[model samples]
Target chain A: MSLNPLHEIHTRRFSRNLGLGLTLGAFIAIIFGLTIVKVSRGDYEPPRAPTATEATQ
Target chain B: MSDVSINSPEFTGQGFEGEAQFGDFFALLKPRVMTLVVFTAAVGLLAAPVPVHPFVAFCAILFIAVGGGASGALNMWWDADIDAVMKRTARRPIPAGKVTGDEALAFGLTLSAFSVVFLGLASNWFAAGLLAFTIFFYVVIYTMWLKRWTPQNIVIGGAAGAFPPMIGWAVATGGISVESVLMFCLTFMWTPPHFWALALFIRKDYDHAGVPMLTVTHGRRSARNHILVYTLLLAVLAIATAFTSVGGPVYLVVALVLNALFVKGAYDIWRRDEDVSETDNFSVEKKFFKLSLLYLFAHFGAILIEAVLTRMGMGGWT
Candidate 1:
């Protein structure tokens, strides 16, 4: 039997791996998607700059 | 037949003076598996009833992730020979000769100790203890002990994969609750069908590798039957979790929809004729496997949504 290249092993399970990988990728996408939604919904605000009096104190 | 005993270490110093690149070492961590662990663990942390210091939560997840990676490295070291024979895992670092067994063992052990100790410092001993136990269960119980010995390995050994969420909860609450246990049960019950579906399609790989996966030992018909049974049980447990503390209308709806699809996919797999060959593409088995992935992430995603809603005082029953 010819030696199988190491890369081929991962390639061989492409569909199966993709099925799992896509789930994780989708989770990441959902996180970013939610962040966008939250921002759009005005749920997030930038940290306020300190007043000069508070800063001096 | 080329077979190496699991207890013995085989170090092939084959790749450039036993030197491995960063990617090779990283591959030993099984990044794909780590992704699942991290996501579930993060969900657990976020979904907890108690408040946490954001820094503490981050550290807990980071250390837990390190512990998870440690388990992967150790598993790779032990299963290198078997990994080499299976087409699905032949490219793994140790099996591919990119990293040697000795290196993997040392790397795994070091990270394991570091993760456990620092996690205790960052969070609570309870979470750290759970993390330590999760690593032990994966490496010692599942990989070394059960995997080669029994066809029911994945069924019994799936506890390792299910512990992360509980560990994450402990990180926040320093104790267990009905909600955490329910989450654990959801993942635990889901494991068999998810893995068995993959096994249905890749049965030949296990045959070649001499691993005693259910498919290889009992044949395809039994594996299919087992998948259907487990998926049915998982459906009940998953849906029932919706009434618990961590769940609400969002989680309940998600559980209702996904579990229905999951049960249907499993039924389709069960109805397949055992003699159905690979040339037909094992389409049903493959589709069921894909559905299984969504079954998990979607449930956890819903739980996270419930947590967010509850934080906003819009969750659970009145």
Candidate 2:
């Protein structure tokens, strides 16, 4: 008996898979871009170290 | 007998029918409605006094569009029953059997949560909260409660569609102001007359679907009178907006011309009886409906131009 590797369901659902893949990829790109913008804008900066004068005070 | 034959009773018993494609899922988002969302939101963002980074602005609009699309999915999910009955909506994804109601519900809820969270992270919580409220209002308040119960459904439900610009403004300004309120008012006021004109042309769809549209409950002449009255009120609000911070000389001119045409259209709709409308195949009503679309786009476009010119130091009277 010969074995077939491809299934008909795969062909029928290819477009849906591709679309979901593209949508997820785009979401990742948006997140990366947003992270860069927020970081560059100091939105996620750690709190600054206290100065000795301030610490003494 | 071939096991792969789709026509076989065995294959039919396996229950693979009307399998949705990528386009079907996208249709669940109501892309046509998203265009209005994207446009109005962009206008609100740009028309604000503060400047946003281009990429950030892009993110804000994208998330707002997603939020709007999420609401559309929810609307389709909830209204699948009515949609199946109405000629205008019978072909929607859920009603047409391409996408199941459960699938639509899951899709809508997921996108709603994602959009609200991402919008809060991308811009501000105020805008995100507004978007969240908008989804709730559209899905719950309007779709679930108001739509089937009252003839004033469109009047109140219009608020859902009117919110994008306000969300856009809040994204930029991080708060609401008179400017954002005015923009919201502009869309809010324009919606009733716009929809009533459509109801005039497709009254039977609502009648058959058992939806309490103004035309269904109040009657055609009453709907016409409502259209005229709303158009007059909308014209006053629209023209008054020309003096606000978002408006300029260009907007004033556009508003003047468009309002005149809109009022004329409404008047024409009001003057005609059903006999005349039927004779002309509702051509005047159809023309009015088309003009309503142009009226909105032109108004927002003019505001966008004013914003651009203001940035260039050539915009408003100031």
Give per-model TM-scores: 0.81, 0.94
DockQ of each: 0.03, 0.37
**How well is each residue in B25-114 modelled by candidate 2, as lDDT tens digits?**
999999999999999999999999999989999999999999999999999999999999999999999988989999999999999999
Best by DockQ: 2
lDDT of each: 0.84, 0.92
Model 1 lDDT per residue over A1-57, tens place: 222344333343454366557745854664565456547656568888999999999
The Cα RMSD in angstroms, rounded to one decimal, for candidate 1 relative to the true structure is 11.3
Query: Each model's RMSD to truth, in Å?
Result: 11.3, 3.0
Highest-TM-score candidate: 2
Q: Going through the candidates in order, what is chain B's TM-score?
A: 0.94, 0.96
